[model samples]
Target: MSVLDTRCVNQLYLTLSNILSISESDLRQYVIDKKFELLDIAWSEIDIDEFFKTVKSNVNRLKGNIIESVTISHLSSRLEYECNKENIYNLYSALTGETKLRKYLSDVGIECIHESDVISVFFHGERIDWKQYEQTPVVLMLQKRLGVTSSGDKCINGFLFSGDIHKNMNVTHIARIPEFLENLLRILKVHEAIYFWERNAQPYEIIFKEKFSGIIYDGDDSLSLEDKNIKTIKHCISFLGRNLFNEWNQNDNPIIRLKDDNDVLADQIISSRNLKTNRIIFK
Candidate 1:
């Protein structure tokens, strides 16, 4: 193998076991000159799974103490153990990998992951020190995967009670509430909310403030916090469909929906939508 090529692959985190044997100075120069070109090449060659494996290997092997380890399953371990069998499976499937366990995503179809899910893999693994890993473009992308990094600042773990449920809420239970109204409210902390009847939404459609982004998931089979949230949201939507249709069949009057105003995201979304008596509304 070319010394040039092996060094590039090494920088990409493909294999860390001395794929190249150049000296420290030569190694640094090799990376400085050629790493970016290799990164662009590798990005197209590798699937996300292999890329994740490379990340884990490098993190475990890194020589310093700057990696801040975080994973929803690990962070919210107790929450999963305390839940139901299906719930536990849902949680397990989310953290481990969802493409293996579930065949169909209920009403929308299995292909709906891109449409239904949001912010998948929030806070992937840990808050890695950019200074330590920035030598490699792959690691740079890993940091980006964890979140958007500004200049100079070291990345750190973030926590909050609400706002961007994609980044905050660690449980799937809230997502299972109909129209995702309840979970929506908890994230945004608004007093009112609305749910648009799209299969899965592009965040641009919900535009309001700094709280906006569009289509944040990559539709991987791997389990993630976003998977739990999406699955729960779908179940909740199905429940609403059944309950509302059934009640309408019996009484033939307009259905009055009940909701908790305390959920911030839900309130903002609902308040944004203007609903007439018989039709679904989209804002």
Candidate 2:
């Protein structure tokens, strides 16, 4: 079985505890001590700093406390154990954090299944080739650094990244980018490129720097506000609630492209894999 590091365990514990309102001490008592046994590791094998830092970062990020109450209830219904908070916490944390827990739970007649990974992120309308860049610094920045700020159904394997070839611009908005990046990716489920134009940036260009790139449009008077594209942009604003719209629109950044002129943009979205044809089909 693959061993989870202390950092991963802490992330799992803190995330589940925050969502379910179960304290860490309770988690240790009811789950770690009684339900499943964890393998001991040497001190030198663990990054002690990362272990504590992850715990601290999880605490800070959860300060917002935005995980909806209804979500917890819905998750409780799907659990295999008693619906009480402690059992629910153990069930969910085990499913996510420990492979050993799966075997133990299965022995007790709980159905434990693993879901296939979903490529939930897209760059410049393409699926990210994560394997090729596993050792690259971009992976560290985008995955490790950005992950500290990510929320909602957090999983290590859910995101994807792809984009244009311009890898030289300074990504000044990395912090703000994560706030709306996941929502923008979900919007791409039914649409293509979500273009945001800044008054200072060039028109119809995908700017790439700091290992990321995205299509941008300049909301200039020369480009009439009455244009259909502009109307579509507004439609997107109205469609995606005010909070998400404001997140993307802050600091003069306005969405300029969602679907292309001929609706060819969705073709770039990876919706289905046609194995017989050896091609990816879009939404």
Candidate 3:
């Protein structure tokens, strides 16, 4: 009895098509097959609108299934050599064009503040409060300006302005493409570490904690990584990765330690209890 937003379905179709490089007919056939196999229903039984409503309701799960299928079919190496530090940065550079990363981010309405080893990113301009307007138009315009057509390119413009992917809500802090990509790549690395740990049959919590001791900590004595959930730990890792990317260039060793300033900013953003006080906080 609930109405579904057709636009969400359309965008998901386009996104999957772009990501998989499949034609519309092929995608349609694939969906039909999937529905038959999973739901045990003929495609003719349901109206197209109802089918799209189902997809909209389960978009995240569908996306995950597709990604897992792709990974199983093609990415045998997984994150080992493919997702190395160099390769990730190269992909970032390629998406951002020839201009420097900071400059490209600034051009697309992101403000970067560099203080010592820390680099803080925020949404800039007069309209600091983005909660008032609808987010789809804002996201579409920003994506056009940033030339974000490929799924390979990180497109977090919606979440940058609005707090969530549905683009119906707002947040105090927001991050554009760079931070989104950084967080994604860092999570990939964490997955790599998890794979390694699992394959080696290593002890669970203690050794895993040792591997990421200093990198995940934000210099806050009270807030400990050991006490945090996997999601929070991944976020902290991405924060560290972003700071490291800003401070060190391609030629530097990728395993450098986080400096004092980086820890200070991390403490302010991640450890600070204030989450909903709108005013350009970290994403």
Candidate 4:
């Protein structure tokens, strides 16, 4: 079990955040515009003072309406019990003042273990090595952080750090989106529907039974237009209708990485037994 300390929680959050290619600074701007929020932490990152002030004005009166005001003796027990209950994270978010995110994380069943010294996260699925792949985005960032070659079928990566080497860059396989378009594939039941997206090229057709299509463009389609992305993705999913969007929103994101209880990255550590290492290593 991992503790909910600064390093662990932030690492976990970053690993799972969907805007893989986007940097934290860029994402923060979206937070400023209230396009989407990162619950509480995003506000802290941009301006700690302003965030606290906002919270004080909007939240102070609810001091007694939350778990924070409860007696300390029952805090630990209550938290543990809630953590064990299904979607009890809703309670945690209510306490933390971030209900939507709490609902989201709860659906995924990812939880932190601050109650024990080992301080770890637990998942319902035990098959993949999630912890290892969780940090791949950081590695992806490294390739851009410093100049590195990414020729051949390899991608330049920089997630691993050595006590001697600030970063260890390598050309490796990008994790193949651990889970396939399972949710979208479910849409296969209705073949008449087209796909849709807010960005990127999307497949116009499915492989008959394979379910869910990819970007439909051949060697010559634009993959970065906001409207085009939406159209392309819409082509891939038009069969499901608007409620499907909520399904996408409500669908619990399963573990898309390898999960190892012992691995930690700050000490320049990594688990070599991940999906990318075994099957996706470019060279």
Model 3 per-residue lDDT tens digits across residues 1-283 = 1111111234334544443445545545445545433243322233434434433433322232222211000000121211211211223333343434445445455554433322323555532232333456544333332334223332111110011121122211121223343332232233443333224321100000011232322233343443322222122222223333342121211111222212111112211111122222122
Clashes of 1: 25
Ranking by lDDT: 3, 2, 1, 4
Question: What are the runs in model 3 whose C-alpha is more than 4 Å off?
Answer: 1-99, 109-127, 133-260, 263-283
Candidate 3 at residue 13, lDDT?
45
Error of 1 at 172 (Å): 19
Residue 235's lDDT in candidate 2: 25
Expressed as tens digits, the lDDT of each residue in 1-283 for candidate 4 is 1111111223322321221233434333333443233332221134423433432323232232111100000000111111221221212122123443333323455333322222223444432233344345543332222122131111111111111111112111112110111121122221121121112111110000000121122222433333322332122121112122332221111101111121112222111112211221111
Q: lDDT scores for all predictions?
A: 0.24, 0.27, 0.28, 0.22
lDDT of 1 by residue, 196-223 (tens): 2223222111111111111112232243
Identify the runs in model 4 with alpha carbons over 4 angstroms from their true place: 1-98, 116-119, 125-131, 139-283
Query: Model 3's lDDT to the true fold?
Result: 0.28
The TM-score, computed over Cα atoms with residue i paired to residue i, of candidate 1 is 0.17
Q: List the residue pairs that clash in candidate 2.
A: 123-162, 169-209, 197-217
TM-score per model over all chains: 0.17, 0.16, 0.17, 0.15
The best candidate by TM-score is: 3
- Residue ranges of candidate 2 with Cα displaced over 4 Å: 1-126, 141-176, 179-283
Write the residue-wise lDDT of candidate 2 on 193-280 in tens digits.
1122121122111111111011213232243322422222222222122222222222222322211111112222223222222232
Q: Judged by TM-score relative to the true structure, which candidate is superior, 1 or 3?
A: 3
